[model samples]
Structure formats: structure tokens, C-alpha cells
Target chain A: MSSELLFAVVGALIFTLGVAGTVLVANLLRRILAFNLMGSGAFLVLVGLAQRGGESDPVPHAMVLTGIVVAVAATALALALLRKQHEMKDSEEELTEIDDG
Target chain B: MSATLAFDLLLSTALVWSAWRTITANRLDQAVVMFIVFGLLMTLAWCRLRAPDIALAEAAIGAGLTGALLLDALGALRKGKTARRRQ
Candidate 1:
């Protein structure tokens, strides 16, 4: 099989796996990781398609770079939110403990 | 198969395995490590796909930045869990 076809098939499988992980995993961090995986898989498929012609296309490469940046920013935001949520929970638990004492 | 095709197949298998492990790992730390490995393998895959720009981005952003973020988040999570246990 051609390299492009191979990449497309693997990319689809990776995408599917990522989707399942995102839906099924309980941990917030794991879910975020899975989401990134999904994004990468999609990028791979796009790059694969871009290779169909005799010469490699530049559009998909540029798009994937933009996507990588966006993905990193989103991940940073998600992690910050998670940290904030955990801090809130810890404080709440401490307050309850003090009230009980 | 030729050497390049053989290498591609190997990289693809590694990618799938790492992704599976990352998702299913029992510990968050293990999962994060697997994800980093997966990201690096993806960088290789991008190179094979003739997308060097993506390969560079995958290395710097996908693996480096993302791994740092995940590790930092994991640290915060562990601290919280430990504090709860102590109390």
C-alpha cells in the first residue's frame, strides 16, 4: 500500500481510540490527553491527504501548525481549570473538618 | 517490504500501542508518560509523511509543552490527594 493510504488508515484508528478514551475515561487529565490524541490523529489524516498529489501540499502543513498551537493553549487552560477546581475542593474539605472539630 | 515501509509499519504499531497504554494506564503518571512517548512517535510519523513542519511542531508543542503541562497538573493533583489523606 502507498504511504498515504497507510497513514490514513492508522490515523483513523488513532482517532477512534482517542474518542473512546475521551468518552470513557474518568480522570480529567486523561481525558485531556485523549483529546489531544484525537487532534493529532486528525492532523495526521489531513497531512496524509495533502500527500495525494505528486508534490506535497503546503496548506495542510500550515493548518497543522496552527492546530498544534491551539491545542497547546486549550490544554493549558483546561489544566488551570482543573487545578483551580482541586484547590476549591481541598479548601472545602478543610472547612468541613474544622467545623466538625 | 522495503526498509522505509518497514520502518513506517513499526512506527505505526508503536503509535497505536502507546496510545492504548496512555488511555488505559492505572496511574495518571504512567498515562502521561505514555502520552509523551506517543507524541514523540507521532513526530517520527510526521517526518515519514513528509511533513517536517508538523514534525517540528509535534516535538516542541505536542511532546514538550504538553508533557510539561500534564506533569505539572499531576503534581498538583497528587498534592491535593495527599493533603486530603493527611487530614
Candidate 2:
């Protein structure tokens, strides 16, 4: 098979695995990791498609670059939210313990 | 098979394996490390695919930045858990 085709197939499989992980994993952090995996898979497919013609296409490359930046920003925001949630939960638990005591 | 093709096969195998391990690892730390490895392998895949721009972004942003973020989050979670246990 052509390299493009090979990469495309692997990319699809990766994307599928990412989707499964996102859906099945219970932990919020794991779900975030899975979502990133899904994004990478999608980027790979786009790159693979960019290689279809004789010359490489620049449009997909530009798009993937933008995607990478956006993904990182999103991940940072998600992690911050998770940390906030954890802090709230911990404080709530402490309050409950004090009340019971 | 040509050497390049052989390399591609190996890289793809590693990518899938690491991705799977990242998803299924019991500990969040293990999963984060595996995900970082997966990201690095993805950079290699991008290189083989002749997308140097992506390879660079994947290395710097995907693996480096993301790994740091995950590790930081994991640290916070661990500290909270330990504090709760102590209390």
C-alpha cells in the first residue's frame, strides 16, 4: 500500500481507539488524555490526506498548527478547572468532617 | 520491504501500543507517562509522513507542554488524596 494509505488506516484506528477511551474511561483526567489522543488522530488523518497529491499541501499543515495551539489551550483550561474542582471537594469534605466532630 | 517501510511499520506499532497502554493504565501517572510516549511516537510518525511542522509542534506542544500539564494535575490530585488520608 502507498504510505499515505497506510498512514490513513492507522490514523483511523487511532481515532477509533481514542473515541473508545474517551467514552469508557471513568477518570476525568483520563478522558482528557483520550480527547487529546482523538485530536492527534484527526490531525494525522489530515496530514495523510495532505500527502495525497504529488506535492504536499500547505493548507492542512496550517490547520493542524492552529489545532495544536487550540488543543493545548483547551487542555490547560480543563486542567485548571479540574484542580479547582478538587480544591472545592477537599474543602467541602473538611467542613463536613468538622461539622460531624 | 524497504527500510523506510519497515521503520514506518515499527513506528505505527509503537504508537498503537503506547496509546492503548495510556488508555488502560491503572495509575493516572502511568497513563500520563504513556500518553507522553505516545505523543513522541506521534512526532516520529509525523516526521515519516514528511510533516516537519507538525513534528515540531507535536514534540513541543503535544508531548512537552501536555505532559507537564498532566503531571502538574496529577501532583495536585495526589497531594489532595494524601492530605485527606492524613486527616
Candidate 3:
């Protein structure tokens, strides 16, 4: 198989695994990681598929570059949100415990 | 197989393995480390695919920045959990 096709296939596999992890993993942090995996896989597929004609394309490379930056930003935002949520839950639990006591 | 083809095979294998490892590691730290490894492998893959620009971005942003963010989040989570436990 050509390298392009090979990479694309692997990308699809990674995407599938990411989907499974995102759906099934209970940990919010893990879910973020899985979401990242999915984004990486999609970027791979985008680049790999465009290059299947045996000539590398610059357009897809540009797109993937943009995608990488966006993914990182998204990751940061998600992590911040998760941290806030965790803190809120802890405080809520503390409040409930104090009430019970 | 030619050297380039062999290298691609090696890279692809490593990529898949690391990606899988990142997902399945028992510890959060292990998984985060694996994710960084996977990102580095992806940078290599982009280089092999003739996209040096993407490779550089992947190394700097994807691997480096993402790993830092993950570690920070993990540390915060651990600290919170410990504080809760001590209460």
C-alpha cells in the first residue's frame, strides 16, 4: 500500500478509537484527551487523503496547521472548564457535608 | 522494501501503538505522557509526509503545549483530591 493510504487507514483507526474512548471513559480529563485524539486523526486523514495522488499538497498542509492551533486552543479551554467544574463539585460536596453534620 | 518504505512502516506502527497506549494507560500521568509521545510521533509522520511546517507546529504546540496543559490539569486535580481526602 502507498504511504498516503497507509496513513489514512491508521488515521481512521485512531479516530474510531477516539470515539470509543470519548463515549465510554468516565473521566472528564480523559475525555478531553480522547477528543484531541479524534482531532489529530481527522487532521491526518485530511492530509493523507489529499496526498493520495502521489504529490504532496500545500493547501491541506495549511489547513492542518490551522487545525492544530485550533485544537490546542480548544484543549486549553476544555481543561479550564473542567477544572472549574471539579472545584465547583468539591465545594458543593463540602456544603452538603456541612449541612448534614 | 526500500528504506523509505520501511521507515514509514516503522513510523506508522509506532504511531498506532503510542496512540493506543495513550488511550489505555492505567494512570493519568502515564496516559498524558503517552499522548505527548504520540504527538511527537505525529510530528515525525508529518515530516515523512513532506509537511515540515505541520511537523514544527505539531512539535511545539501539539506535543509541548498540550503536554504542559495536561500536566497542569492533572496536578490541580490531584491537589484537589488530596485536599478533599484530608478534610
Candidate 4:
């Protein structure tokens, strides 16, 4: 098989696995990790497609680069939100405990 | 297979495996570590695909920034352990 074809197959597999993991994982943190994995998988597929076309298509590469930055920014923001939610739960628990006592 | 193809295959496998471990890990800390590995592997994959710009972005934003954010969140969670609500 050609290298490009091989890359396409492997990239497809990675994307499938990533999406499956994202759907199966229950914990919020695990879910976030899965989302990032899925994003990477998609990015890989885009790059592989660019390679398969021969002579390294610059457009796809540039688009994917933009995507990577955006994905990271979104992930960081989401994690911050998760942390805030966790803190809120903690504070609520403490308030309840005091009321019970 | 050509040497370049062989190397690409290896990098692809590493990328997929690390991604799986990142999400499937039982511990949150381990998951974050695996996620960083996954990101680094992705950077390699981008390079193999002849996308140097993507490789750079993946290394900086995907691995560096994202990993730092995850570690910070994990640290905050650890500090608030006693404050967690009983399930």
C-alpha cells in the first residue's frame, strides 16, 4: 500500500477510537480528555488528507493549525468551568454540614 | 515499506495508543499525563504529514498550554477533596 493510503487508514482508526472513547467515558475529566483526543484525531485526518493529495497542501495545514489553537483555548476554558463547578459543590457541602450540626 | 512510511506508521500507533490511555485512565492525574503524551504524539504526526505549522501549534497550544491548564484544575480539585459532596 502507498504511504498516503496507510496514513488515511490509520487516521480513520484514530478518529473512530477517539469518538468512541469520548462517548463511553462518564467522568467529566475523562470526557474532556476524550474530547481533546477526538479533536486531535480529526486534525490528523485532515493532515493525512492533505498529504494524500501530494505536494503538501498548505490550505489544510493552515486551517488545522488554526483549529489546534482554538481547540486548546476552548479546552482550557472548559476546564476552568469544571473547576468552578467542583468548588461550588464543595462550598455547598460545607454549608449543609454546618446547618446539620 | 519505505523508511519514511515506517516511521509514520510508528508515530500513528503511538498517537492512537496514547489518546486511548488519556481517556481510559482511571486516575485523573494519569489521564492528564497521557493527554499530554497524546498531544506530543499528535505534533509528531503533524510533522509527518508535512504540516510544520500545525506541528508547532500542537506543541505549543495543544501540549504546553492545555497541559498546564489541566494540571492547574487537577491541583485545585486535590485541594478541595474534603469539600466534595458525598455521592
Instruction: Name the runs in model 3 displaced over 4 angstroms.
Output: none
Clashing pairs in 1: none
Clashing pairs in 3: none
Listed in order, each prediction's TM-score against the native is: 0.96, 0.96, 0.97, 0.91
Give per-residue CA lDDT, model 2, range B46-71, as digits (tens): 88878899899989999999999999
Whose lDDT is higher: candidate 2's or candidate 3's? Answer: 3
Segments of candidate 2 deviating more than 4 angstroms: none
List all candidate RMSDs to the true structure: 1.2, 1.1, 1.0, 2.3
- Model 1 over residues B3-70: C-alpha lDDT tens digits? 98888888889999999999999988999999999999999988888889889999999999999999
Q: How well does candidate 4 match the true structure in TM-score terms? A: 0.91
lDDT of 1 by residue, A1-101 (tens): 77777887788888999999999999888999999889888988888877855367899899989999999999999999999989998999999999999
Per-candidate interface C-alpha RMSD? Answer: 0.9, 0.9, 0.8, 1.5
lDDT of 3: 0.92
lDDT digits (tens) for residues B1-86 of candidate 3: 58888899899899888888888899989989999999999999898788999999999999999999999999999999999999
How close to the true structure is residue A30 of candidate 3, measured as C-alpha lDDT? Answer: 87
Query: lDDT of each prediction vs. the true structure?
Result: 0.90, 0.89, 0.92, 0.79
Tens-place lDDT per residue, model 3, A1-101, is: 88887898889988988999999888888899998999999988999999987899999999999999999999999999999999999999899999999
The local lDDT score (0 to 100) that residue B53 gets in candidate 1 is 88
Question: Model 4: per-residue lDDT, tens digit, A1-101?
Answer: 65555666776776787788878888787788887777776776776776775678888788888888889788888888888888898888888988999
Candidate of highest lDDT = 3
Question: What would the C-alpha RMSD of candidate 3 be, to one decimal place?
Answer: 1.0
